[model samples]
Target: MSLPLTAGETRLIVAAADAFFPPDGPIPRSGSEAGCVQWFERYLALSDRRQRLLIRLMLAFVQLAPLLLGPERRRFTRQSAPARIAFLARASKSRIYFLRVVFLSLRAMMTMAYLSDEIVANAIGMKADTDPFGLGGQPPLERMVPPPTPQASGVRLKGGGPAVEPGLGDVG
Candidate 1:
């Protein structure tokens, strides 16, 4: 299935991803070169309508945010790399919680798409750890750390009071 994003929207996504995960050092390629936009398109195609709409709205907001918050009133994709990075830095710390959330969400999406690429993963040695059929020297489940004992920590109720266990606390 095709993504619902427009050409401009797609460009915005690519620009944002490129700014967040620049093709520097170990990256070897820009987010656009690494196929971040295509990854996002595939993700959106599989997502629910509401999720797709939310992501689209976030992209629109990011594209237009530079005009409102930037020193120069330009679209985000039109800005220079440094300018784009500055705009994102400011947006990530905005007093508006929703704006911060949107920035973080976009950053996460871009980072995930970039890092999850087979080339990137292999370069980072993650590909070396995979044993799909458990044929490798995997640790036994019993060697794993046990779950924390709930009783060791004080359990608090939703309203911030300590949880009163039945029969453990004084009852009428």
Candidate 2:
């Protein structure tokens, strides 16, 4: 629900995030429970139309990955916990090059969101607000998706400037 994606897409993303970073032993809070969905919502809210579409396509592919596996046609969101885990493990290590990329991308996204949680970050030695600027309170997506560079009055509003490292560009 937090994600800007469609209902089904949001469900799929939540399911995927939970599967990717499920609780083990003492680590409480699955990825979705740790605010991964909300993280993704902020991220997508800043993405351009094309980027959002590509992300949705990747999510769709991940949702349908079971079909690519075998006769198990159940969508990713509907699968049991164990089955979802197995699918994610297999997809991430898949021999199919693009499948590996897609699955890895999903895993990375979930991991980033999961690590953004203060509890997990502290546990893992990542300071949440160590920065003097209080950047830790800002969504990571804000840096990843900066505001567009200023354009001329009559410009057609083309692409933004080149990609940048986080917090590197000056908005002013």
The superposed Cα distance between candidate 1 and the true structure at residue 140, in angstroms, equals 19
Candidate 1 runs further than 4 Å off: 1-3, 128-172
The sequence of per-residue lDDT tens digits that candidate 2 reaches over residues 30-108 is 7777888788888888888888888888988988878767446788888887899888788778789998999888888
Which candidate's lDDT is highest? 1
Q: What is the per-residue lDDT of model 1 for residues 66-117, given as tens digits with 9 covering 90 to 100?
A: 8987696899999998899998998888998988998999999998888778
Q: What is the C-alpha RMSD of each candidate to the true structure, in Å?
A: 7.5, 12.3
Provide the global lDDT of candidate 2 against the true structure.
Answer: 0.78
Count of residue pairs whose backbone atoms collide, per candidate: 0, 0
Candidates' C-alpha lDDT? 0.82, 0.78
Name the lDDT value of residue 148 in candidate 2: 85
Best by TM-score: 1
